[model samples]
Target chain A: MVMDLHVSLPRGLTLANPVIAASGTFGFGPEYSRYVDIGSLGAVSVKGVSPEPWLGNPPPRVWETPMGLLNSIGLQNPGMEVFVRDDLPFLREKGATVIVNIIGHTVDEYARVASRMQGEAGVAALEVNISCPNIKEGGMSFGHDPEQAYQVTRAVRQATDLPVMVKLSPNVTSPALIAQAVEQAGADMISAINTVVGLAIDVEHRRPALGGTTGGLSGPAIKPIALRVVYDVAQSVSIPIIGMGGIASAADVLEFLLAGASAVMVGTVTFQHPGRMQQIIAELPQVLSRGGFRGVSGAVGQALPAASRPQTRGGDL
Target chain B: MAGQQFHDGQVDARIVRREEVARDHVELILESPALARAVPGQFAHILTPGMLRRPVSFSRIEPDSGRVGLLFQVVGEGTAWLANCQEGERLDILGPLGHGFAPPDPSRPWCLVGGGVGIPPLYSAAAQWRESAPDVIIGARTREWVLMQKDFEQLGLGVRVTTDDGSWGQAGTVIGPLQEWLEGHADGQVFSCGPTPMLAAVASACRGRAAAQVALEQRMGCGIGACLACVVPARGQTQMEYRRVCTEGPVFLAEELIW
Candidate 1:
C-alpha cells in the first residue's frame, strides 16, 4: 500500500515525512551525518542558536535517569553569524530541510536571530525556543507567562518571512492559554512540549547531578506529559502542531499525530540508537496502515475529542 | 548491506572472554573486526541496560585477531551491568573513537603512569611499545587492587607498584617513583591516566621537567561530539574554553588542559 507521509505547515513550509530531528540532540547537522542520511530526514532542526556564542553550563551537563535523560546544556551554539557562515551551507549542500531553532536572552535577540535567517539558503522554517528550561532568563520564563510568550512569538513572527513555530513548555500550569496567546500573536505553527523541568541529586557529591543544579527532562519518561500538552494545545489553536517529547518509535509518532501534532520530532533516543529516525520513517507507513489510516493527515487529531479535532490540511493517500 | 554493518562507527561485537581482574574490576575481551582499528588511549561506547552508553578505554587492541579488551571498575549501575555481562553475548559498541596517544619515539625515553582503572590503556600502550621497554608505574589503593603488573613486566618493561597503605612496592602514590623516573630521564615523555586529582598531580609534576599527555574521563551523554556533555576546560586562543573530550581528545597534551 502507498502511504502519504507529506506534511504541510503554515506559510508554505513542507516536510517529506513527519519525523524531524529535534533541536539540541541532533547538533547543527554534520554531527549525526555519519550515522544517518541527512537528506532523508523529514527536517533537521538544528540546535538553538542565539545572537551570541554561549559557553553553556559547567561539567556534568547530563544525568541519566530511568528511561530518561536530564540535561542542562544551556543551549550552547556558535551564534547566528557563525551558523550562517558554517552550518547553513553544509545543510544546503546535503539537501536537508533545515529548521533553525532560535533562542535568546531577550525578545530582541530572538528577533535578531530570526531576521538573520531571513535570506539564508535552505532554511525551511524557524523554531522559536521560548520554552528551553535550561537557561536562567528569557527561555522558559517567556513560555510560562502568556504575555511574555506572545511578545516573543510576535517579535520572531515580524522578524522574518519564514514559517514561525513557537515551542511550548510543559512547566506552566495552563499550556493551552500560552498556546492560544502565541496563536493570536501570529505564530504559524506550534511545537508542543519542550522538556519538563526536573532535578536529580548526586548523593556522593551532596548536590545536584547537573552542573546547573536542575535540568530539562526528556525521553520516554515525559511522553505522557508531552501528549497531554499537545492534546491541550491542539484543542486551543488552529495552527499546525509539531509534537515532541520521548518519541521513540512510529507508534509514538502516531500517538502524537492522533493527539493533533501534524508531525513529530525525535531526540534523546537518537543518542542511544542514531539510526532510529530512519527506521521510524521506514516503519511509519506500515504502522499507519495497520492503524487503519491511509496517511499521516488522517491520523492527525484522531485521538482528540471529536468536537476539538484539528482541521488538518494535506493530501491523504 | 555493508554500510549497515558499520554505521556511525558502531559495531556488533561478541564478548570472547570475561575475567575478574580484581575486586570490583572486570576485564572483557570483545571481538569485532570493525573495531580492530582501535589503539591505545581510544575508547569504546558500550550500550548498557540504562539510558546512556558507558565509555570504557581500550586496554588492548589486537588487530590481527580482531579483539579489543576493556578493563573497568563497577562504579555505578552502568558498569555493574557491564561487569555482569557474560561471554558470547553480543554487545552494541561504538568505538576506536577519540584521538589516541602518539606513538613513542624510539630515540627518546618514555614512562607510563597509571592509577586504579586507568592502567588499562597504559597497558595497551606498553604492549605497543614492548620493544622500546618503557617504564611503567601502577598505582592502587592496596595490594589487592594492583592490576596488570605481570602483564607490563611480561612486555619486557620494569613495573613499579604503588599503594596508599604501603601494601605494595612503594609506600605512597605513583608520584614518588614518577619523580625518580623523571629525574633519571630528564628528556622523557610521560603518558598518564587516572582520576582527575591524580592526573592533576601528574600534570603538575611534569610541568617543567617532561612533557605529559593525559586521558580524561567525563560523564558523557552521546559518545559522539553531538551532545557536548563530556567537556574539559582547555586553554583556547584568547581564553579558556570547554573542549569536547570525545571529539577533541580523551587524550590531550598536559599543557593544553586548564587544570
Candidate 2:
C-alpha cells in the first residue's frame, strides 16, 4: 500500500508533506541539499532578509541554556539586493519551493521588499517578520501591537500578489489577537511563536550570557509554549497556520499537526541535527500510516482534546 | 572525507590525565579507535549527557596508541561535567570535526600564544612546532586563570605570561609583551588562540610585523560545516561573509578575519 501524507495550502500551493525548514536555521536551502534531498521536504524557508544589509549582533551572539539556546543574532543577513543576486539564484537552481522570510523596520520597508519580489519567477512566498525590535525606535517590537501587525501585513499584502505568511512572536500577551488581526488584514497564512524573549546568566563572568543582554529563546525549552500558541491561534485564524518552535522528531511534527497547524516548521531541532528535514520527511509516511491517517489534512487538529475551558491566564484564549 | 561508524550505547572509554601545567583544566585521553581519524586542529564533540555536545580541540593525538587527548577547562555545565569524568568511564564523542589550525612553519622562530581556555589547541601546535622551539606567550585575566606555565617551561622555549590583575608574569594583556617581541624578532610567525579581544590585540600588534593566525571561539551547533551557527566574519568581504568556526576553521589567518 502506498503511504500518503500530502498537505495543501491556499492559492494552489500543495506540499507532498507538512514539514518546512524554519527560517535562519536553514540557510538559503541549497546548503542542506549537499547532505539531504531538499526537494523531498514540504518547503524550504530561507534566512531572514532585510530592506538593507544588517551586521547582526556582536560576538557571543548565542548562549546555550538548559534545554534550548538563546540567540541575539539581530537578524544578520545580506540586503535584499545581495540575496536576490548571490543567494536566490543558487536556491532557484535547487528543486524546492523557496519561501523568503522578509524583515522590515517600517511598513514601507515591508511593502518595498514585497513589491520587488511581486512577480519574481522562482520565489514561492513571502514571510513577513515584524517581530524584530527596532534599533532606532528605542527597542519597540513591531508585533506586540495589533495595529502594527495589521499595517505591516496589509502593506505587504497590497504590494505583492504572492502568498504572505506572518511569523508571530510568543513574547506577546495575546497570540490569538495578533493571529486574528493579521488574518483579517490579509495574511495568507500564519507561522506562530518565533521565539520567546529570554536571557542567560554567566555565573563565571557575573553577567548576562548573551552579548545583546537579552535574546530570543529557541529549541526544546520553547516547544510547549509554541504548541500552546499554535493551538490558540489555530482556533482564531481562518488562514492556514504554520506551527514552529522546538519541533524535533516525526512525533514532534505530528504534535503540531494535531495541535491544528496545517504545516510545521522545524527550528531549534534542525540546529541539533542539520539532516533532520530528511529524517522528518522520511518518517512522516510510517508515522501517518501507524496513526491510520490517509493524508496530512486528516491529521490536522485531530489530537486536540475536546477544547477544555479556556485557562484564566492573561492573553490565553 | 573518512567513513562514519555507528556505535550503539558503546562504553566510550575516558581517562583523566594530570595537567602538565595547570590543575583547572584536565586532558581526557580517548581510547576509541575512531579517534585515530582526527585532524590536527579538528575538535571532538563531547557528549556530557544533560548538555549538548561541547567542542574541545585536540591537544595531541597519540597516533600509535589511538589515544586522542583533549585539553579543556571547567567552564559551563558541559565542561563542569567533563571535568568530573573519572578513569574507566566512557564519553560519547563524535569527533575531529571542522578544520584545525594551519600547519606551522618549521624554518622560522614561530610565536605561539594562548589565553585561558583558548590555550588548548596551542598545546598541540606547540608540540608540532617543537623542532623549531617556538616563542610562547600565555595570559589570563588573573593569576588563578593562568594555565599551563610549567608545560611551556618544559618545552625549553621562550615563554612569557601576563595577567590583567598583575598576579603573574607581566602587568598587562598579551599584546604588550607580544609587541615587544615582534619589535625585535622581525621575521617570526605568530599563532594565537584566546579571548576575542586578546586575539584581536595580537592581530593588531603583528599588523605588518609578522603573519598572525588566530583560533576563534563561536558558539556552535554542529561542529561540522552543516550548521551555519558558528560563523566568524571574514575580512574584505561584503554581505559579512563568514567562515564556519567548525568547518572552515576554529583557526584562521588573522589578516583574513574581520575581527
Candidate 3:
C-alpha cells in the first residue's frame, strides 16, 4: 500500500521527505551532488560557518573507533562572506532547500552573520550553532549553558526574518533546559544532539589521537544518547525538534521520530557512504508502510508506553 | 559529467593476482575496471576487518589488464586482514579515490625516493618516466621490507637501496645515498613518497640542491573532498590554505608543504 511520507517544517518550509543532510556532515550541498540528486531529498544544512574563516584543529583531527567516528574539526569553514558569495550560488543551483548553519565566538558575531544572511535568496532557514568549545570563555562550551543558548538564539531570532533553529549539544547536562530556553527566547525549531564529547588513545603515540585532545563523537556510538535527548527535549518544549547523531538507516530515522523528533538529520553514516542521503530518502516510504503508518509525521513521538519501552540501562533506546 | 552511484556492500569485481615482492608487503593486482582510470596519486578504500575503508594508494596502474597494484604493510587489523586475502577471494573496495601523483614531465629528470611503504608510488613514477628512467632511491628498516628493487632495476634506471639496520644496499638512510649521488651527478628534479619524517628529512637534505615533491598520508573518511578529514597545512597558500591529501594531493611540491 502507498503511504504518504511528506513532512513539513513549522515555518513555511515543507519537504518532500524527512531526510536532511545534517550540517557539518554534508558540506555546502554541492559536494554530494555528484553522488546523489540534491533536489531529491528534503533539505541540506550546509557546513558550519563563522564570521571569519577557521583553520580548524591540527593533524590527526579524526579517528574511527568501534562503529563510531570522532572529530574535532572545530567548524573549519570559508567564513560568511565567501560562503554567501561562492557557496550559496552553487547550493541554490542544486534546487534543494538550503539551511545555512551559522556559528560565532560571541552574541554580536552571531547577529552579524544572521543579519547578513537575513534577506539572502534561496536560504530556507538559519541554524545557529552554539555547541562550539568557547576558547575565550575558559573552555566552557556555549551549548552547555541555557542562558548562553537563549542569548544566541534571541540574537539570531531578532536579527533575521528567516526561521531560526538552535542546534543543541548532547554533552550538556540538560538538553531540555537548553531547548526550553531557546523556545522562550523565540527560536523556531531545535536540532538536538550534536556530537557528544569523547576522546581516543593512539597507544603507539601514548597520547590522545585527535589534535584537539577531545572531539565530538558521532556514528552508532552516540545514537542511543541522541534518541534519549530528542525524547527529553520533545517532552520539555512545544517547538519542533530535528533529531540527529549517527543515523545510518531508515530504521534509525524511525527511532528518532518515534522518540519525538518532528524530523530527522543524517550524520556519520554519510561519511561511510556519500550516496546514503538518497538511499534513506527513497527508503523512508517503505519504512512507513511496514509500520502500518500513512505518513511520516504519524511516526513522530509514537513511542511505546513506559511499561512497553522496557527500561534498558540509561532510559529508552 | 556522468552520474555517480553510492551503495554499501557493492563489489564490482574481485579477481586477485598473486605477486609477492617482499616479506609482510605483497603486491596485490586486483581486477577492477572502474579503478584503472585512476590518476597517479589517488587511492582506494579497501574494506578492513572491523573498520570500513582503510585508505590505500594505488602504487601502479596496469590499464590494459584493468589491474591495480597496492603495496601495503601489515601494521594493524586492516592490513593484516588485507594481507591474508586470497587470490580468488572477493574483497569490497571503493575506488580510484583521493588525489594521485602529479603528471610527470618527460623533459625533466625526476629523482624519486621512498621509505618503506612510500616506495610504491615511485614505481609508477619510474614507469611514466621512460625516457630518462628517473633516478630512484628507496629505504627501509632492514632488507626484509625493501621491495621492488628488481622491478626498478628492470626499468633500465639507476636504483639506490638503503637499510637503517645496514642489512641491504647502501647501509644508511636514503638521504645518505642521495647525498652521495648528488655530490657527483647534480641535474635532476626530486619526487618522494613515504613516512612523514623521511620525507621531511629528504625535504631538508635537498634544501639548496633541487626541487622535491612528497606524498602525504592522513586519516580519512571520504577519499573524496566532501569530508574534509584528511588535511595538511600547505607551505605557501592562504585561506583554504591547507591541502587535502585526498583531493589537492597525496602528492605535493616538497617546498610547498609545511612538513
Candidate 4:
C-alpha cells in the first residue's frame, strides 16, 4: 500500500513528512545528526540567525521544572554569514531541507537578513522569528504588536523569494488578531506558540533560577496553551499553520494537526530523548492510519469545522 | 581515536552494582558493552522515567567485562531517585558523548587534581596516566568527604589529600599542595576536574608553568549539544563565546576557558 506523508504550504515548499525539527531545539543539523539520521526527517528548522552573531544569555540559562524546561538562551548563533558559509553546506550535503530561522531587532534587520539569503541555493524556506522572549529587543515585541508584525512580515516577504514562516508567541492576549494581520501582510504560513513567558525561583537563595530572570516555558506544561493558540490562529488565518510547544509523541502531532496545523514541529521533548525526532516521525504513520486519515495533509483540521461557532470552543471562526 | 564502540546514540543499560562511595554520593556500575570505547573524561547520560537524562562522568570502565561505573552526588530529585536504584534495574542511557581530554604527552610530568565530586573523571584519567606517575590531589570539606585516596595509590600515582578543617593528609586546600609541587616541575602538564573554585585555582597555578585541561560540569537538558543548556563561557577574540559543555567538551583546555 502506498502512503503519502508530504505536506506543503504556498510557494511549493513541500515537507517530505509533517514532522520537522523545531528551530533552536535543533541547531542547523550537526548537533542532532550526531544522534539520528538527519536525512530521514521531513525538514530541519535551524537555529535563529541575526545580522551579527549573538552571544546569548549567561550561565544557569535553564531550570528544569516539573514536566517542563524553561530556557533563556537568547537565540545564540554564529551570525548569518557564518551560517551560510559553515553550516548551510553541511546540511545541504546531508540531503535535508533546511529552514533558516532569522531574527532581528528592527523591521529593516529582518529584511536585511532575509535579503542576505536571497540567492542561497540550498535553503528550502525562511522562518521569521518574531516571538523569542529571551531577547531584550525586537523579538517578542513584533509578535505582540500587530503593526510591527505586519511590517516585518511584509518587509521580509518583499526581501526574499523563499516562502516565509512567521513563528508566533503565546504571551499575547489575542494571538489570532496578530495572526490575521500577518496573513494580510503576506506571511505564507504561521508557527504558533514560541514558549510562554515563565520564571522559577530558588527559595533558599531568594534568587531567580534562570540568569535571564525570565524565560520561555515549554514541554508538557505548555501543551494545552499551544493547542489553544494554534486553534485560535488556525481559524483566523488562511495560511498554513505549524503547531509546536511541548509536543513529544506521534499522538501529540496528530492532535496539533486536527487542531488546524498543516504540520507540527517537536521541541522541548526532543531534549529528553536524543533520537526523538525520528521516533516521532516513525510513529506518525501509524497514528494517521489509526485515526482514519489517508495522509497527513488530509488529517489537518479534521476536528475543527470551518463555518461553525468555534468561539464556544475558546476561539473564533 | 578510541572510536571502536564509542557511540553518540542512546542505548539501554542495567545497574549491575551500586555502592555509596561518600556522604550523599553513590556510584552505579552499569553493564553496557558500548562503554568499552569511551575515553577518560567523556560522560554517560542516565535517562529517567520522564525527566531529562542526568549526565555523570565515567568513573570506571572495564573493557574486558564490558561494564562501566558512574559516580554522582544526589543533589536533586532526579538524582535522589537514581540513588535509590535497585541492582538489575534497567536505565536508558545516551552517551560516551562530548569531547574528552587530550592524551597526556609522555615526555612531560602529569598531574591530576580533583575537588569533591569532580574526582571521578580525573581519577579515570589518572588510571590511564600510570606511566607518568602523575600527582593525584584531592580536596574536600573533611576527611570523610575525600574520595578515592587509596584508589589513586593503587594506580601508582602519588596522592595528596586536603580538607578545609585539617582532617586529612594536608591542613589546607588541595591546590596548595599542587602549587608547591608546581614550583619544581615548571613545564609539566596537568589534567583536572572539580568544582569551579578548584578549577579556577588550578587555572591560576598553571598560569605560566604547567599546561592544563579542566573538565567542567553544568546543568544539562539534552546531554547532546542541541538544547544549548549546558554551556560555559569560552575565550574568543573579541569577547566570550558560549561553548556547550556536552558537545564541545565536558573537558577543555584551561587556556581557552573564560574562568
Top DockQ model: 1
**Candidate 3 lDDT tens digits, A80-159:** 99999998998888788888989887898889889989889889898888875423241235688888778878888899
Task: Give per-model TM-scores.
Answer: 0.97, 0.82, 0.93, 0.95
TM (B chain), model 4: 0.94
> Candidate 3's residue-wise lDDT over B1-259, tens digit each?
0133445323355757756677778777888777777776677777664534677877777778887788887777778777888889876666676566666665755678889998887787677556757888899999988878878888887788899999998788898877766675555577888899899998888777867778888887666666677888886444336667877788778877776
For model 2, residues A24-51, the per-residue Cα lDDT tens digits are 7777665556555677778888877777
Task: Tell me the tens digit of each residue's lDDT in model 1 across A1-317.
Answer: 88999988888888999999999899899888988998999999999999988888888899999989999888878788999999899999999999999999999999999999998889999999999998998777999899999999999989899999999999999999999999999999999789999999999989989888899999999999999999988888888999999998899999999999999999999888888899899889999999988888889998999899755555442
Residue-pair clashes per prediction, in order, are 0, 1, 6, 0
Specify the poorest-scoring 10-residue window by lDDT in model 3 chain A.
A308-317
TM-score ranking of the models: 1, 4, 3, 2
Candidate numbers sorted by lDDT from highest down: 1, 4, 3, 2
Q: Residues B1-259, candidate 4, lDDT per residue (tens digit)?
A: 1111223577678899999998898989999899756889999888765457889999886778898889899888889989999899977778788998899988888888898899888877877656767878888888888888888888867788999999987888878888887987868898888888789889988988989999999888777787788899999897889999998899999999988
Which of the two, 1 or 3, has more DockQ? 1
Return whichever of 2 and 3 wins on lDDT.
3
DockQ of 4: 0.46
CAPRI-style docking class of model 2 based on DockQ: incorrect
User: Native-vs-model 2 lDDT?
Assistant: 0.75
After the best TM-score superposition of candidate 1, give how far the Cα of residue B35 lies from its true spot, in angstroms.
1.0
**CAPRI tier of model 3:** acceptable
lDDT top scorer:
1
